[model samples]
Structures are given as C-alpha cells and as structure tokens.
Target: MKNLILLHGALGHSSNFEPYESFLSQHFNVHKVLFHGHGGSEIPAAGLSIELYVEQLQQYLEQQELNDIYVFGYSMGGYVAMCHALQYPGKITSILTLATKLNWTIEGAAKEVKMLEPELIESKVPRYAAQLMTLHGENHWKQLLPAIATLMTRLAVKPLLTQTQYESLNLPVQMMVGDKDAMVSIDETLFATKNIPNANFAVLPDTKHPIEMARPELLIGLMKDFWKI
Candidate 1:
C-alpha cells in the first residue's frame, strides 16, 4: 500500500487529520505529521518557517525510509509541500493542497497579518480561540500568533514556492479550493495548477476555507480520485 502523509495547516496540529484517518487508512498507510512547535512535539519559541518544516518532514521521511509517498498538505502545510517537492524531486509521489495561498507580496502579507489580531479571534470566534489555546498551552496561543505573522511577513519578501518553481516540478500535483474561500483566491489556485506540469484544480462548491471541516466528503473524494484508490 502507498503511504499517505497528512500535513496540517498553520495553527493546527496532527489532530486536525483525525477525521480522515479511518477512511484513508483503509486505502493506504495514513500518517499525520505535526510540524515543529505543533501538537505535543517540541515547540520552538520563535516558531518555524516553511524551510524548517520541510527539513523536519524530510528527516521524518528519511527515518522511516519513506522515500516515495503521497503528501496532502493544507494551507501553510501546502506551501511546505511545494517546497519539499521542488527540493527533493522523485521523493514525493504526488502532492495535494487545499486552501493554500499561491500568491504573496510584502504589502499583501502585511495586510493579512492584521487579521491575526488577538482580541478579534478571542472575541469573534471564541470557540476557535479556546481550541487554539488548548492546542497550544494556556496562553501560548498568543505567542504563536506573532510568530505566524512574522513568517507571513517574511514570505511576502520571499515566498517558499514560486510560479517558476511550480512550473518546473515534474511530479503530479492537485490543488483544491473552496468556492467561498475568502482567504485564498480561486484565481491564484488556478494559476498554480496551470503552472505545474501535471496538475489539476478543483473548486468545491458550497464550501469555504478548511475543507476538512467544511466538506470532508469532497476532500476524501478528491483524494480517492487523485490516488485512484
């Protein structure tokens, strides 16, 4: 059986993949990876960049001798996946990304960082705020916010993945975005698919960001089709 590695988005942990475990495990060896400073793994106070996350993932694959596998990355994790594919060709069998932003610029990134406002989340989305706090330590969630903002700010200056790089990656890649995803634009998602050599794009209707929670069935269907399981 082929191995299926699930990479969670920023501010999320391996637990985010629990919903897909049972279903995907029946078809392949499903593995959920927690990026550095996420889940119960060692937390880096300064947080991690996409490159660092790629290195950690590479080491994990090496330790398990998982040279070839399917990598499904969500949001930030997807950016990491593209970097990994570019750096280590022939190592990844395929890549699937959902709700991953493909465009970045310093000004745009800085504006996005504003949404990470602490008071806003704690006030508007208290449930999510509570979850973040639980995922991180009691008050460590706030610390993670600034670190994430810093990474985004840096990405604006230098993105982890670029159009030229995406066009050069020979491996198959499938990117999906929700129809109502306000965070990531459909145009950019389509742009990525068009640049990649063997890539496909899907727009999930009646869905929004976080497809895992918005429409898990559609996500599973896409995976089944992509992997042909």
Candidate 2:
C-alpha cells in the first residue's frame, strides 16, 4: 500500500488531520506535512510561496526516504500538492485536492485579501485572532498575514498549476469542491480537469468550504471511491 500524505490549508496545522488520522492510518502509512512557517519549522522571511511549501515537502520525503505516496491537500495545500506533483513526478502516485480555488484573477485576490485585514481580525474576530497568535506567535502571525496577502497577489499573476502544466501530468489528479462553496466555482474546477489528461472533478453535496472541518469522512469516501482502493 502507498503511504498517504495529508497537507493542510493555509492558517492551519498538521493537527488538522487529527480527525482522519486513525482511520487513514489503518490502511496506509499516514504522514502529515506541516509546511514552513507552520508547526515547529522555522518561518521564512521570503513569505509564503508554493516553492516554500514544495521545498519543505521535498525535504520531508528526502529525510524519510519516502516514495510512492498518495497526496491529499486542502485549499492552499491542495495547490501545493499539484505544484509538487508536477515539479517532482515519480514519487507521487496520485493526488486528491479539495476546495482548491483554480482561477486566481486579480478581482478574486482583492476580495480575499480584504479578509486578512489585521484590524478586522483583531477587533471583530478577536477569538480567531488570538488563536492565530497562539499558533503562529504574535510577531510571526503579524508577518504571516502580509506574506500570504503577497502570495495571493503573486498567484493572481501566475497560478501554480497552469493549464499547460496540468495537461502535462501523467498521474491521476482528482479535484473536488463543495457545491455550496462560494470561494471556488465549479466551472473553474471543471475547466481545470478538461486540460488535465488524467483528471476528474466532483462537487460534494450539502457541503461548504473547509470540508475537512465539516465533513472529512466524505472526503475519505471520495478518495476511496476514486482510487478504488
């Protein structure tokens, strides 16, 4: 059986996989990747980029001597998975991504960037703000917000997974999103799959963004059904 690697969304940690850990481990060696600026790893000043996450993943694999793995990524993590699989092919057997917004137009970036407003986070959503501070540290979380904002701007200009790049993938790629997810449109995912030679697309019923937090088992079931494992 191939080892399973779970990649969490931005502003999230490896613990995000806690709910699915036991069940997933029963079938495959489960590895949770805590990207740079996350977990115990040192935060980089270069900010958040697919390159940063991919480098961390590559290091983890090299350190563990791992190969023939299955990758499951959420949101930003999902984007990272596609980038990684494309950049370094042989090690990854398959990839499954959820809520990974495909199209990154400048307009889309502006809307999402506003949500990272430090003032809003500190005032209206204090609890959420405190959690981030605790998880990422006061100074680092402050730095992280802007870094991610910059990353969004960068992605708008150059998406990590482009049509030409995705079409080149030789491995199975499954892209899914919640039907109710306002952040990512079904059309974008459908369009992405069209160019991906070995890709498939799906929209989960009665679900929303952060499906891992809402219905992780549904994701697991989808994985099993698609992989036919």
Candidate 3:
C-alpha cells in the first residue's frame, strides 16, 4: 500500500479532510499537512508562496524518509502538489486533486488578488477573517494576517501554474470536481487535461465548488479507485 499525504486549500486546515481521512486510511497510510502559517503553525513573516509551500512538503517527506507516496490535494494544495510532481518526478506515484485547475493565468490570478485585497483591509475581527484563522490566540492571527495579504498580492502578480508548465509533468494525475463548481469551470479543466499524458477526470453530480458540501462519498469512491486499494 502507498503512503498518502493530504493537503488542504487556502483558508483550510488539516481538519478540512477529517471527514474523509478515515475512509482513505483503510486503503493507504494517510498524513495530512497543515500549510505553513495555517492551523496556528509557525510561519515566516513573509507568509507563504506556492514554491515555499512545496519545499516545506518536500522537506517533510525527506525527513520522514517517505517515498513512493500518493498525494491528494484540494484547491490551492492541488496546485502545490502538481508543482511538486513536476519538480521532483518519480517521487510521487500518483496525484489526486479536488476542484482544482492548472490554468492559473496571470490576468485571472490578478483579478483574484484584487478581490481578496478588500477582504484583508476590512479588519481581522470580521467573521470571514475567522474562517481563515484556524488557531486560537490573537497573537498568532496578528502575526499571520499581514503575511496572508502579502502572499495573496504576490500570487496575483504571477500565475502559479500555466498550460505549458503543466504539460511538462508526466505523472499519473486524477482531477475530481463537482458539476456545480463555480470556482472552476469544467471547460477550463478540460483545457488542462489536453496535454497531460496520463490524466483522469471525474465530476460529481449535484455538487458545487466546495466538495465538502456536495457529496463526500463520491470523493471517497474516487480515492479508492485511484489508489486501487
């Protein structure tokens, strides 16, 4: 059986995959990573970039002496996982991404950054702000808030993944999405699949951008199939 590492999206913590971890554990040994600056973990003042995040994960895998692992990432985490596979080929046996797309264009990413700027400037006390803050204590939040905004702005300036870059990865990849996913359109995802040498795509019926709310069973089934366990 392959060891598995699970990564969550922006504003999400390790607990985001709690609902499905037990199910996946039956098939693979699972370890969930809490993104840097997230879940109350120590973070650099500069916060995180996709590149930094992948390095952190790579170090973790190396320290643990874990290889031949499977990676399952959701949203932003999915992007990081994809990059890792490209940078460190043959290390990851298979990759599964949920509700994520590889076509992160500079124009589109900038628009996303524009949207988040207002939210960051609004104030840390807002309920929406709380959603991004997983750890307790105001000290950690105070330290992490600025980093998050800065990182968001940085991402806006540069697209994390591009079609040409994604085509470079030859790993087996499976993308699981929801039919009602408003964040990423199926058409956009299809464009990404065009160049991937070994890729599988699945859409859950009556689902939305947030897979948690749609149907967990569908995701679980896909995981089982992908892992063949």
Candidate 3 Cα misplacement greater than 4 A, ranges? 114-130, 134-146
Compose the digit string of candidate 1's lDDT tens values, residues 1-229: 8888899888888888777888988987877788776654565765668888889889989988885599989999888888988898888999999999879888788888987877889999999889888887677778777778888888888886778898888998999988999889999999989999899999989888864556678788988899888
True lDDT of residue 57, candidate 3: 85
Candidate 3 residue lDDT tens string, 120-190: 53474466556554442445665555565566566656766677766887888887777888777788677
User: Model 2 clash pairs?
Assistant: none
Please, what's the RMSD in Å of model 3?
Answer: 2.8
Worst 10 residues of 1 by lDDT: 37-46
The estimated TM-scores of all candidates read: 0.94, 0.92, 0.85
Q: If both were scored by TM-score, which would come out higher, candidate 1 or candidate 3?
A: 1
- Clashing pairs in model 3? none
Backbone N/Cα/C clashes per model: 0, 0, 0
List candidate 1 segments past 4 Å from native.
Answer: none
Deviation in angstroms for 128 in model 3?
4.1
Between prediction 1 and prediction 2, the one with superior TM-score is 1
The candidate, 2 or 3, that scores higher on TM-score is 2
Sort the candidates on TM-score, descending order. Answer: 1, 2, 3
